[model samples]
Target: MMFLVIAVISTSIISTSLLPNESSHIPFLNDDNFLDWKDQILLTLGCMDLDLALRVDEPPEPTNESFAAKKNAYDKWERSNRLSLMLIKSHISQSIRGSISLSDKVKNYMRAIEKKFVSSDKALASNLMNKLSGMKHNNSKSA
Candidate 1:
């Protein structure tokens, strides 16, 4: 029983540490899954760069005004769009799990997302913004 308890504790620590931290405000681009899983991060990172360029030279850092302003309806709409993409991404990941090679999986997912973007609701733009912020793309020189 004592051995079981220690093992469980150690396992919990390792697993929890391995899971993504959603509240860290760090972008998802640098994650192993993001790095090896797909090219979607590149698109997301590019969009973020464009959005920030439009806003100003620098990307929007966490601030009171920006955070409060993003609470508007447009923000909600944007968030929804990102969520939809994430859902689709999750599905793609599950579908290809342990079957497709990493590069192929990424390529396939990217193609699928491009298609989905055309039909996606615009309200989810905020979510796109959120996804783009932390994305570190292999070819991206902007950040």
Candidate 2:
């Protein structure tokens, strides 16, 4: 009995240390990090098994006559959407979050995020193009 107790305590300690910290975080999204943030968010949600809302379209509302599987799918989807939205929103910068339209669906929320970043990306590309076009060989002054 003493040996059994010691083994149990050791196992519990090891498992506890191996588990992810409750406060561990995905980094907050900012104007410059949308691409990396989007990837990390999806990866984190997938690891947590909470990505159903991102994988499938929302189901029609279940009814008294609905099949058990249908009800189950909807329940899973609803839970995924709710949790995903919370996680995504909580990890975003307040300024960015305030600008994004509210979305009850994870897939749509991601789409909205991508749209926000797309403009930034376009502006960056334009700025780089302008700089490249303005460059001269300067052979007259260079060694």
Candidate 3:
């Protein structure tokens, strides 16, 4: 049963990437608006790790559990948690990569979202955003 769930989740992730480029909305997990729900939850967890990193003056750590969807079928998706973590890592990487096009409003909104998962100062999200922006700028300059 557990293996079946992992297989399904894995297949879904691949299919999500391969799905036709239709503009139609599915009322769930569409790519047009923002990251999918799974990505959003993972990003929130990543934000928590980012907060912890700042407080401890260490690098961010992988999530243990909060990213789970808490559904009965999760046993199948359980193994995919590692894959989910990787996806979140990629999202952060892509977010940083795309930060050059991110508007101040978007950045602020994302920072606010990150703040919900963090316990420390609300300012840290801004700080992280600034750092990411700077990094993106530097990368573009070098390219």
lDDT (tens digit, per residue) of candidate 2 on 1-143? 99999999998786445435534347899988887778778877877778889999999979999999999989999999998999899899999898998887889988988988897899999999999999988669655
- Displacement of residue 88 (Cα, Å) in model 1 is 7.3
- Candidate with the greatest TM-score versus the true structure: 2
**Runs with alpha carbons beyond 4 Å of true place in candidate 1:** 1-12, 24-104, 122-143
TM-score order of candidates, top first: 2, 3, 1
List runs of model 2 lying over 4 Å from the truth: 1-25, 135-143
lDDT winner between candidates 2 and 3 = 2
Candidate achieving the largest lDDT: 2
Residue 56 error, candidate 1, Å:
30
Q: Report the candidate with higher TM-score, 2 versus 3.
A: 2
lDDT of 2 at 69: 98
The residue-level lDDT of candidate 2 at 33 comes to 81
lDDT of 1 by residue, 18-126 (tens): 4444332223322134433334444343333322221222223444656565555345444434443453345444534334333223334445544344334353666
Full-model lDDT for every candidate: 0.43, 0.85, 0.41
Decide which is better by TM-score, 1 or 2: 2
Candidate with the larger lDDT of 1 and 2? 2
- Name model 3 segments beyond 4 Å from true: 1-75, 94-113, 116-121, 124-143
TM-score of each: 0.22, 0.76, 0.23
